[model samples]
Target: MAIVREKGAMRQWSRSQRQCGQRIALVPTMGFLHQGHLSLVAEARLRADKVVVSIYVNPGQFAPGEDLDVYPRDFDSDVEKLKPLGVDIIFNPHDLYVRESPEKNRESGHETWIRVENLERPLCGGSRPLFFRGVATVVSKLLNIVEPDVVVFGKKDYQQWRVLARMVRDLDFGVEVIGCPLVREADGLAMSSRNVRLTATERKNALAIFHSLKRAEELVRSGETDSSVLIEQAVTAISNAGGKVDYASIVDQETLKSVDKITKPSVFAITAWFGSVRLLDNVELSNN
Candidate 1:
């Protein structure tokens, strides 16, 4: 597979593929590939004639004091993992946003940002205020650079998928945003790059997050539809698991607004801290 490092090169590659009448699907990723990521790549492979996976650890998405400095990264290993997956090109841009000034906490020439407004104000958005702004801006850059027929995102980041999907529609990006099912380990922990940072004990405790969501799913299936009751149970589970709860709420899967009752399609999402690692996972709920 070809590795593309420059935005101009990527756009040229895209133009050539389009000229050849080849449909392309772009899978955006922050390296340190796991089965969850591969699953998205696999889906992309099936959807288009060519697939481009962009490996970027966006600094814009990380807030002050967040884990941007030490987020897990092994470019060589990530490349190896994708080699067997039939990826046509790996768009590893060196830097998309460049700051003219090098002063700390000083404004750079980069002043533009994209926001989904109401969609980014709940769940993970509530805690990490700057998270979605960074995500939206960088993803907008990727969509512009790659210009693929479709882009794939894992629903594991439920809020993120919704935010970007909405952004595409509102901004008229013209690329199909596909949300793949959230992948999980055999024991049910949502696969994440940060899973490597968890200590043995913390990893075992992390199962509580998924388990609680599963139990909540069971309750919803058994005629429990109250959002308050479900959210309370998720919070208590994380607390008892020795993990700190970031946010747990059942929101409409599309609008992302919290529902008073689970009368329609909704998602029970959770973000919790296991030791220093913050992990996200969610389960979709539907009464029908």
Candidate 2:
């Protein structure tokens, strides 16, 4: 596999692949890859002739007090994991991938941002205000730079996947945004890079997020429709399991806005603090 670290090199590599009639698949990620990321790579391998993975921890997606400085990094290990996956090129750009302009830094000038209006203000957005703006902008840049035939994202980030899909459609980016299934551990925890930060006890407590979501699913399946009661029960389950609850509520699956009554299909999203690490999980309920 070829490792291209600079923007110029990646563009050149992408052009060469296109000239050869090789369809390109791009998997954008922040480093410290796990099984979840590899699943996306595997899906890319099946969908396109050439797979390119970009490993850059985006600073814009992180909030002021978030774990930007402390986010994990292990390029050597990440490469080892990708080498066997048949990835053709790895785009690991320098700090300049997306940086504040000198003028912007000097006087707090406005940095260019991409926002999906209604979709960016709910669910995770309620807590992390600037998260999707950073995500949409970086993803747009990656799509433009790589010019891939398709880009893959995990369904674990359901809202993100939806936002990107909408952004691509609205902006007329001629690349298919593919959403893969969430890969989970044998014990049922959704695979995440942040799982490494959990202490032994915290790890045990983290399972509450999944279990509570499961409970909510069971209630919905049994014909219960009260959104308030369902959310209260899920939050109670998480707290009983020793997690500091952030928010657990049901929202319209498509719009992501909180729904007072479950007249239609909805998604239940839960976020909680297991020790100091924040974790999120969701379940989709549909009649079909």
Candidate 3:
């Protein structure tokens, strides 16, 4: 894969590709890739003539005390994993928003931010207030930089995927936002880059998050539709397995509001903490 670190050069390559009439597929990531991330790359390969995956750890989404400092970075290893996939380009830009003076950001008024508004009020946003704005902004930057015909985001980050999809629509980004299905480990823990930080026991306990979601799916299949009842069951299961529940909610997949009954298809989503690591997972349910 040809690695382009600067945004201008990346855009030039994208322009050249467009001139040649090659469709570009982009998979944006924060490096330290895993099988789940690679799955997105594989999906992109099937969807477009040229695949471009970006590996930049965005600072905008991180909070003051979050795991931003140690978020994980192995660019060399990440490239090795992408090599076999026949990826065409890697846009590893250092900064999407460059400040003339580093010290000015602390004192200067924030100039720009992209907010999905109501879509971010629940789930991850409840605790991480600045999360979506950073995500929307950085993703908007990437969408502009790569200017791909299609962009792929994993469904594991259901909220992020939805936020970016909405951003693309509202802003008329002219790029297709494709949400791929979530992948998991054999024990059901949704694969994550942070899974490496989980101690042996914590890793095992982490399975509770997925199992609890699975239980909710089983309940739905068995004709249970009350959202509160499902949330209670999920909370109990995760607690028993040693996870602290952040939120166990069943919401309308589109609106993201808690639904009283599963009259139509819905999403059962949860976020729990095992030690300092926060994990999220969700399952989709529909009558059909």
Candidate 4:
């Protein structure tokens, strides 16, 4: 795979692809490549003639006191993983690519931000205030820069995926957004780049998030309709596993508003802090 680092070079490369009538697919990531990321790349390969992956550890997306400096990154290994996936270009740009506004450009200013209302205020949204804004802004920039026919996101980041879908539809980006299933570990924990930071004991405890979501699903399937009970069971499971619970609730899948009755399909989203690392997971509970 050819690594395109400079913006001018990447734009030139993408222009050449467009000139040749090749449909392009873009996969935006924050480096620390894993199976989940590779899975997206593989999917992109199938849908578009040319696939471009961007590995920028976005600083804006990270909140204050978050792991911005030590988030985990290995560029050589990431490149090695993408080599066999037939990735046409790896757009590994510096901070300037996405944070090129006058404020960010100035030596003493902060990064430019982006936010979508209603959707960015609940679930994981409450904990990380600036998170979605950073996400939305970077994603918008990537879409504009790559100008791909399709962009792929992993469903593991369900809220982010949903928010981006809404952003694209509302803004008319004219690119298809595809959500891939959550790839998991043998022990059933959803695969995540942050999983690298987990200790042996913490890793075992992390499985509780998945288990809790499963139990919530079982309760929903067994004709239990009380949203509070399902959320309680999930919280109990995660706390029992020694993880500090953040928020566990069932909300409308599309609107993301908390629901008292499971009258329609909803999502059981959970977030918790395991040591210094924060992890999140969700399960879709459909009454249809």
Candidate 5:
């Protein structure tokens, strides 16, 4: 249960592990651990000899009025939960994007950023314009700092997983990116740190997101290949359940472009707002 808060220490530890011929896996997180996050840790544990879990709430990922200030965080609780799971190191850096100094913390002076281009332009990217740019830049920093053999991400953020995978490939990162299945609560609401912020009624209303996707799945299975029909149905269902639909898209799984039909592998991805909390969920669709 070693907790590392500095990049140099983390890189040193990563180098030491490599010297011992140990394979390392990184499970980057924003703290406030839930079962969904632990699932990623479990996958990381199985894939590599050492697991490094990062718990930094990246400010760069949030826009002007987003939940960055109020995002849930419980570092001590997170450590206690991961202790039982055999996490080798917790890379909880104070701030990875800024330069640290005693007089005053200042910017890193680097204006560069990474973008996966097309994959980030739709869905969540459509609403949160800066979201993927911030995500890609910070994740690039993490990959460079940890230097793990592989990195794990939850498919709950389907676009994010795709974006990072594309970034790793385009930038020639020497680490494998693995996306685990999206986990949900018993009632079908996708597990998220922001789930705690949902009021009782809002939580109950959020079930429509899951049901909408399930209905979309049923439609696709029952010969409804029209992408517009699926998107309309999903949007209507969520809106009727007291949630605001952000985007209900049926897009090609790889290119992430909205498709006219389910001619190839595709995913029905949805993002909606339950109260002030924005949640994402998706279902893989194929004409079967």
Candidate 6:
């Protein structure tokens, strides 16, 4: 696959595709090749004539003290993985975030930011206040730069998927955003790049995140609808397994507001810190 890094070249190549009437699909990622990422590419293969996967660990999306420096990187390995997947192009931009103004901040010199209000107030956003601002801004940059016909995101990052969907609608980007299913490991833990950082024992304990979500699902399916009860059980499960709970919540899938019962399709999502690694997982609750 050809690696397009410079903005000028990327725009030129994408424009050529548009002129040739080629349908482009993009899988935007912070590099550290995983099955979950490849799953999105598989779907993109079916959806478009050309698949462009951009592998740039966005600095804008990271919080001030987060693991931006040591997150993960294996560009060569990532390229090897994508070659077999029929990925036509890999847009590895050195810097997707350009300075809009001269005002410099901790993360960037640009003061311009894209904020998705309401959706950013809960879940991951509640903790990482500037996250979706970083996320929305970079995604808006990529969507504008790549100008792909479609972009694929994993449902594992359920809130992120929803946030970007709302951003696309609100901004009228005209690119189809597709949410693929959450991919998992054999042991039931959601596959994440950070999984490599876990100690063997911590990895075992990390399974509790998934287990707790399942337990909450069971609680909802069995006639328990109280949000407090669900949160209590989830927190207890993760804590017993040695992982500290950041947040365990059940909320309306679309609105993301906490719900009292499974009156509508909802999401059971959790974020926890296992050792130095923070992990997140979610399960769906739908009426029968």
Per-candidate TM equals 0.96, 0.93, 0.96, 0.94, 0.96, 0.95
lDDT of 5 by residue, 1-288 (tens): 899999999999999999999999999999999999999999999999999999999988899889999999999999999999999999999757666566754553557778777888998988888899999999999999999999999999999999999999999999999999999999899999999999999999999999989998898888998999888888898999999988888889999988999999999999999999998899999996
User: Cα lDDT for residue 134, model 4?
Assistant: 88
Q: Tell me which of candidates 3 and 4 scores higher on lDDT.
A: 3
For each candidate, the alpha-carbon lDDT, in order, equals 0.94, 0.87, 0.90, 0.88, 0.92, 0.90
Q: Candidate 4 on 144-235: residue-level lDDT in tens?
A: 87889999999898899989999999999989999998898888888888999999889999999999888888888899889999988888
Q: lDDT per residue, candidate 3, 77-184, as tens digits?
A: 999999999899988997567755866655464469998998988889899989999999999999888999999999999988988898899999989989999999
Clashing pairs in 4: none
Candidate with top lDDT is 1
Candidate 4 residue-pair clash tally: 0
lDDT of 6 by residue, 1-288 (tens): 899997788878988999999999999999898999999999999999999999989888898889998898999999999999999999999766565454755665467888899999899987899999988898888888889999999999999999999999999998999999999999899999999999999999999888878887787778887778888878998999999988888899999999877788888899999999999899988745
Candidate 6 local accuracy as lDDT? Answer: 0.90
Task: Report model 2's TM-score to 2 decimal places.
Answer: 0.93
After TM-score superposition, what is the CA distance of residue 75 in candidate 4 from its true location, in Å?
0.9
Question: Poorest 10 consecutive residues of model 4 by lDDT?
Answer: 95-104
- Supply candidate 5's per-residue lDDT for 136: 95
lDDT of 1 at 266: 94
Q: Which stretches of candidate 5 lie over 4 Å from their true place?
A: 100-108
Write down the worst ten-residue block by lDDT for model 5.
Answer: 101-110
TM-score of 1: 0.96
